[model samples]
Every structure is written in structure tokens, then in C-alpha cells.
Target: MAFVYDLCVVGAGMTGAAAAREASIIDNYKVCLVGPAEPKVRKVNTGKEVFGAHYDEARIASSTSSKVPVWGILAERSIRRYSELEHLSGVHFYDSVGSLTVGTRNSEYLNKVEKQANSQGYAHSMDILDSQQLRRKYPFFNFSSEDQGIAEENTAGIINPRKMVMAQISVASKNGCDVIRETVTGIVRQPDGNSRVVTENGRLIMTRKVLLATNVFTEIHNLLGDIRPLYVPMPQTVTLAEISPQDATRLRNMPSLKYRGYGEPSWPSDYLRNNNDQIDFYMLPPVRYPDGKYYIKLGHSDDILKGPLQVSEMQKWYCGEGDKALEEQMFRLLQRLLPGVTFLSHHGDACITMVTPNSQPYVDLVTPTVGVVMGDNGWAAKSSDEIGRIAARMIVQSDWSYDLPKHMFKLYTNVTGPPPASKL
Candidate 1:
């Protein structure tokens, strides 16, 4: 017997999972989710590929954006819907520990963050804290006297990204989505105008429409043939520090912290090759990992370089051993900032995310039969739910009546040259 679906969503990461789940809400449509299993090391190759993006335990979910107003709007929508999503999906994912965006007074980043909050009418969701107020609330931070912060009391916190994705896909499955754990190797358009997705094991899934939420892998695999590159895949490294129960208790009340680094330049251009000083970093509160140890996660915003870092394949870049000197620099900063905080050693891992020129995601139809929800730019977790909802509605309704502005996410085809031969 042949298999067919009304919609097929590729990539089971945050966007794909949520899209599949959202599309399956209606009983009339048949939706199938085609994605790869987690990538792993092996002596021989299997068809399965790991989604390195969502492998982490915690991701910052905040409505307060230091970058753009649209992001804050998207984040606020997603954060507001999280509870409803959890209730409907019957899976818990948000932590609601609150979050802080700390920066020096008159800092460019903080200015943008405050502007977004005020412009988006979400200023009530956060409290702007002067350096003294910030110190009073969170004394652990070693902020300069001129530092200021924004406290998202309820609308921000750390999220279990893996569980969030699982809950979404699980809900999709319950809602009648055909969940296939196989990888889609190729997509071909049929004479009848339907799209046929071919799996590595020779299984075929025919569908009227397709949503590619493959994130960095979208570019890595060139899944949309001849579709101009909408995003560039870049490698990001995260450092993890296993903490003791006592340390966790001490830091239990600490919100997820986004510090722009007060006294030094932490941006990518500051220290691309050198790692002697700490770069700007986002710090998550201690969360229990699969190993049963509580660990705090920190990731640097400084690009591995100032420009986009190209990744050729998904399997080639999964592990993030980290730059030792950089890790040491981070450790030094943590010690100076949070005195007496215990660390049970540390390690690093790398993940890839699609970064657009403007640091926004693309949520437009690439081809008539294909739509995309890629280019997360590292904010996919908090924005996944809303992004998925938008992508699904665009495909199913075939209309643009979304509540959020749809102009920024329109597809841009900049394929100036010939397409690469077969691989990303």
C-alpha cells in the first residue's frame, strides 16, 4: 500500500515538531512528520541524523529582546501561549524562574532591549533595574556601578528545550500525525502537483504541501533545491559547569542572566582568535541533566568569527569540546562575579543554528508546494510555538492573515550562482 499525507513537515526540531502538532489539530488533514533520529558516532553510517540544536537541556525563554521589537512580540506571544500549549499537550516544559538582561548604563544592547519592550507594549512584563536596584535584587552579579538591567519577572526563564520539542511532537502524534522516525533524503514534485518525500530506506511519503523547519540543517542539506540561501549555518559553543547541591541551593533563586559584560568588550570582534578575556554570555540557572548532576549552562554570543561560520554536514559538527582558553576565561569571570560558587569541573559542546542577515527567521513559502520555518538565529526555543503556528496556518490556509506581522519573514531568493552539487 502507498502512503500519503495532506501535509508533511520535515525536521522534528522545535519548529517542525510544533508545526506538525499544530497542523494535526484539525481532523480532516493527514499530517506526517519526517525527521532523523539523534545523530551519534558509529563505525558505520546509518541514515539517521541528529538535530544538534535541541540537544541542550536549557534555553532562555524571554519576551525582553535586546535586539529587535519583532522578536519581543514573537517571544511574548509564545511565552503567553506556553501554558495553554502545556495544558493542551499534557506535557510540562516551562520553568518560569524569571530572567534578567543586564548591561552597562546607556549600553547599546540595553537601549534596544528597553526600546523593544516599550514599543511592543510589554514593558509591564519587565522591570528596568538600575545598578543599585540590580545589586539589591541579585547581589551575586558583579555589575559595575553604571550597569543597568531589565527583570522579566514572569514572562521569562529557562526552558527544557528537549522536553518542549517532545511534548509538541507527542501532542501532534496524539492529534493524528503520522510520526515517522526516518530521514527524508529527497523531495520531488509529482506530475499531479503533489510532492513526494523519499526516505533513506526507500520509503515514500506523498503530500500536498511540505514545511522545512530543519534549522541549520536546511542549508547543510540544501533541502530546498534552487531556493536561494535564506540563512547561514553557524557553530555555537556552550560551556557547562556541574554544580553541587549546595551550589544549586545557593543559586536557586537566580534568574537566567544575559549580561553584556560591563568592563570589557565581549562581542565577537573583541577576541576571535584570542580567548584571554570573557566574552558576552548568557547564563542559565542550574538544571539537572540526564547524568543526574545539576549544571549551569553558559553560551557566548561572540561569533566563532565575526561572520557566518559555514557547516557542510550535520554529522560533522555535533560535539562542542570547547576552546580551553575561552572556557578558562569564562571560569575566571564566573569566579570573580559569583564568589564562592562551586564548580564540579566543566566541558563544552558545539551546536549549529541558522543565522539570517538580520538575525530573524524565514517563515515564507519557498516553492508553491514547499514552505519554510527556518533561520531561527538562536532564538527558536522561546519563539518556536508561535513560529510553528504561523508556518502551519500559512500552509493550511494558503493565506496571510496572521496576527503577527508577516512582512519580515517573507522568503528571499538570493541564489546568485549555481547551486552546490548535491551536499550543503
Candidate 2:
């Protein structure tokens, strides 16, 4: 008879890697993480390729999330462990340049951010800047007269998603966890009350329990048998502006920016004009990519593609360059935001994010032997470690042991009607 492992985590992205590490360290349990490595070159002709959003170089990391207060809590917990994980794995990925959130003065959004920051005792690490102060401090940025900023100087900055995932996997490998580099095709139940994870390479992994962190590909593979989670795969595009070395150095002190306001009359496109909640955008500081070039990345919160993508349509979308018109619009917006800045070149790429009905992650069990921790909703990269820890504890202890209400992470499946408007 073949040996049965204690737990098998399918999906080696940020959340899955963190869960594998937590499960291995919680006690003496045989754990394995299964997922394919990033492709050397992105090609859509190959029908066997799988892509993840964590293939990027920079993602904003801050304790203040505009979506909900619970997300902020998750970010704080994970940010507190970045240093420890770095030391343990010997991988440096976090940049502590701080983060900035800008919005209208005394607006509901900024008020909620201020309340959460104060309640979390972050007053000492935070600085509130009025419109004049923002202009005086960051002259390169242009903002309206009603805009105010909250600068988080500590535990808020940018993280390289690739390096972060590598760090977690390194720690887990040293803790006696097995790492399998393959794509999981499906998960099936066994006759002995266990689960079998099927891989694309014809390998079967038997375990007492399985956790699916496959993100956007979760529903496409039908891993949960007959039950399907109600999620929409929303397409997202990001534009990168390549600057010269001198320009990069000049903007070395720039912080990650999250802007919430309607800029100039010509800033928004027609799609943005129809929606009241579509004027939000985020920008990352200049980061060096694999090609050894520094580029500043920017993306909008609203979906410019205009429709929820079906699973079959995802591969073709990723194969092609993102919406060229939207990319041009973003480039123009960047130029206006930083007037007189020279951009050597610009390009865009396509990606997908899973949006749930309520805009929160579903970290619940699908059955007695199969569990799931997915539905990123566009905010999981910053808080993945804590989310993984909670999931690991739930599986290891056979119960939901986290302080957060279990219902907050409950699973929603087989719903009718159209999906709700995204709050990302």
C-alpha cells in the first residue's frame, strides 16, 4: 500500500506556500505543495500552461485597506512577520519606503482609514498631510485642492511577489515539507474517506485532507467535485512606464500611492464616467524587473474590459497584450500625475482576479476531507501569510480556531442572479 500524507496543498502561489509552511511548522505532519513553476516565456499556444498573478515584481503592502477593516487586520498580522520570514529563509523581498493613501479631505473613505489607523494605535507611525503639505512634500505628484494624504511610515511599503513566494517555500522546504512542481488538474474523493490530488503529469497524491488555493483557476478545474464557488473572473490590466536611470534615482524616495478621486475632466474614460465608484487607481514605485529595467507600474480598480471573463476565454486573453486603449489612457494619466517626467517606453499585460459576491476570501471546508482557501478579491497578496496561517490552523486542529468570526470566511456556492459590483 502507498503511504498517505497528512495534508496536501494544491497551488504553490503566495497563499498556498504560506499554508504549507504553517502546516509543517504547526506540528509534525507530512505536507506537500504542488504547483507548476513560472514559465520561462509566456506563450498561449501551449494548452498546458498555467499563469498566476504573483508573477509580477511589485505589489503594494500596507495595513490600511479601503475594502474592509478585517483586511487591514490581516495585513498587520502578515506585515509583522515579514522580517522573521526573511531572516529564516535568507531571502530579502520587502522594501520599507512607506505607503501613501490619498483621498478627499474628511471624505468617508479617508475617515474610515483614519479611524482604522487610530484604533490600531498607528498614530505614532502615521503622518496626516493636507493638500498643501502633500504638494510641498511631494512636488512631483499633482493632486486636487480637496485631497489629503495618510502616510504610513512603518510596516507599509512594497513587496516583490515572486521573492515573497520563494521565501515562504524555502522556509517550508527546510521544515521537512515536500515541494512538487506540477499543475494539479483535479481532486477526487477516495473510498477510505481521504482525497486524491491528480496532477497533469499523471501523478496521484493521496492525503487525509486537501486545500485548494488555485485562485482564478479554482472553478475552471472543477476541483470541488459537484459544488462550485460563486466567483467571477474579472480581467485586469497594468501598464508599466520605463524611465531612465537618472529619473529612477530622482524618484528614489517615492512611496507606493493609492489615489481615490476624480482627477481632471479628461482623466477618466467613458467606462469610468458611467460608474460612481470607478475613479480609484494605485501606483507602485520604480522597481527593477527580470529584464534589468526599472519601470513604474499603475493599474485602475475598475474593470476596463467591460465583462466578466469565462474560464475558457482566460487563456486567450493572457496570450495577447492587454487592452491597448486602456494602456494608452493609463500612460497619459501617469504623465499628467507627474508632469514633465520622461518615459522612455510603455507596455501593458493582462491578468485576472477572482471576485466573490461579498468581496471577502472564502477560507472554509468543502467537505470533511477537502478544504479551500481562495477568492483573493485583489487584496490577498499583502495579507496572504495570515490567511494561510488561519487556514492551516483550521485544517490541523479540525476546527476554525482563529479569532475572526468563522462566518466571515464562509463559503458561498451555487448562487443565482448576476454578480454584485466589485468594491476592489
Runs with alpha carbons beyond 4 Å of true place in candidate 1 = 39-50, 219-221, 264-279, 303-307, 416-424
Q: Taking the tens digit of each residue's C-alpha lDDT, what string does model 2 give over 1-424? A: 9878899999999999999999989567999999999887778777755678898999999998766677888889999999999999999989988999998788777888888888877667889999999999888888878789999988799999999999999999999899999999888888988888889999999999898888878766788766778888888888999998888899988999988765645454443421455367889999989998999998877544445888888887777667888778788888878885899999997888888878888898876667889888888999999999988878777788799899778778874333335433
The list of candidate 2 runs beyond 4 A from truth reads 264-274, 303-305, 415-424
Clashes of 1: 4
For 81-183, candidate 1 gives per-residue lDDT tens digits of 8887788778888988999998778877788888878888878878888878988999777777877888998668888888898889888988989888877
TM-score of 1: 0.90
Go through the candidates in order and give the C-alpha RMSD of each one to the true structure.
4.5, 2.5
